[model samples]
Target: MHRMLSYAKGLLWLALCALFFSFSLLLPASAAVEGGYTIDLTPLLDALMPSLLGGVSLLASMVLAWLLRLLARYTGVVLDEKHRKTLHEIVVSRLQQIVTDSYEGNRSAFRISTKSEVVAELAGYAARKAPGAIRHFKLDQNGLEEFVAGRVGAKTLARLKSSPKHAPARLPPKPAR
Candidate 1:
């Protein structure tokens, strides 16, 4: 394709040059003697005019090509920036929704799932802050069951969970004999 384009450009240049040169040859020589000074200016004008016009046309085409290249570059940058910005917005909004629903859904639901390794690491951070409050800190499904049970009952334990302010500093183990 590139070779074909180059060949086409060379042909166009040759054609333009031929046209400019031939215009002089095509003109019938009309010699006028002005006070013994032979001025064959018509032939010169014919050659110069077509060449000048061709040069001007070529220069204009180059400037238009340069402007088009600049325009394409600028448009591409703007579109890519907008695409990245929109993608970031969509991801952030989805994460916000997940965080909101994780804690605000039905009361019977177990919270702060630690099944995934990443979630377990995050839970460890929270557990370290309030080690005495959290229980059944494991990756097994049974931990989710225990969390549900701890959050559902209506006894002092439930009240302690409800109003963390009145919760005891320490809680007894359920299986203690």
Candidate 2:
């Protein structure tokens, strides 16, 4: 029904435009009252025809191009930094959760995508409490490079001689209701 109404409106508008144009053609040319000046209204019609067609066509093409641009922007696939960052954070957080949860609440034997962040936090946290026993424990990962190795410092590394080799642990899955 809405589609039919739109089509009817379009046809009605076209018909009205045609009627106006035909009526415009029937009008007599203007006569000049002053010195040797002849006014021809036919030139107005001639000029209006070309200008109206050109303007309308240009406007239509521009509108179509704008709509297509909007559609492309909405539907097009654009993988950028934000997408990568989101994925990286999700994986990092999930891996960290799994690593932290796998053990019986004590420091787990292993970590995933550790790269020294959570380990440094744990080490530093333990250091404040124990100090001597929790020596230099440096977290490590192979493909995931040392993002905070320098920050861990030398003194921490001395007591923490053995950190487990970097490994990919099973990440925790999101819960199902």
Candidate 3:
């Protein structure tokens, strides 16, 4: 439908151009020159007008096309930023739940600390800091979950269970005296 409308508009413009061409012929001719041929500058001026306007229109369309492309590109960037922020919040919340559950040994009492303002601050901090440490943290939740699960399986996690917030460092054995 749009293509048809554009074609119709082009045809109308062409008809108008033809009418203008014929109208120029009716313009009063200037006095006859030495060669006994009358030269009318009106038709020449009329002929130049369409070409000049077409050039200006072409330039205007090009500028508009560039502006439209730029708008689309920036709009996509903004939407992606918004989506990232929302996803960051979700990931932070999920991670906080998992951490709280694992630390408390069960789902019970998990919400007690999580409901606090301090938990929110901590979640926001992890969301910002952890993404840089884990390359695909923001892009994939399953990947992040697997990563956390893997870390939980490490020896440090067992030590954390016994020690809570403090894990004592293991020193190397001294050589026999």
Q: What is the C-alpha lDDT of each candidate?
A: 0.47, 0.47, 0.53
Candidate 2 wrongly placed segments (more than 4 Å): 1-19, 23-42, 77-177
lDDT top scorer: 3
TM-score against truth, every candidate: 0.24, 0.24, 0.26
Error of 3 at 126 (Å): 11
lDDT of 1 by residue, 90-159 (tens): 4334334434444344333234323343234334443444333343233244453343333232342233
lDDT: worst 10-residue window of model 3 = 109-118
lDDT of 2 at 28: 31
Models sorted by lDDT, best on top: 3, 2, 1
lDDT of 3 by residue, 49-90 (tens): 787677557656755776786897877765565555655555
* Model 1 global lDDT (CA atoms, 0 to 1): 0.47
Clashing pairs counted in every model: 0, 3, 0
In Å, residue 110's CA in model 2 sits off its true spot by 18
| Tens-place lDDT digits, model 2, residues 96-126 | 5444444323345433343365445543343
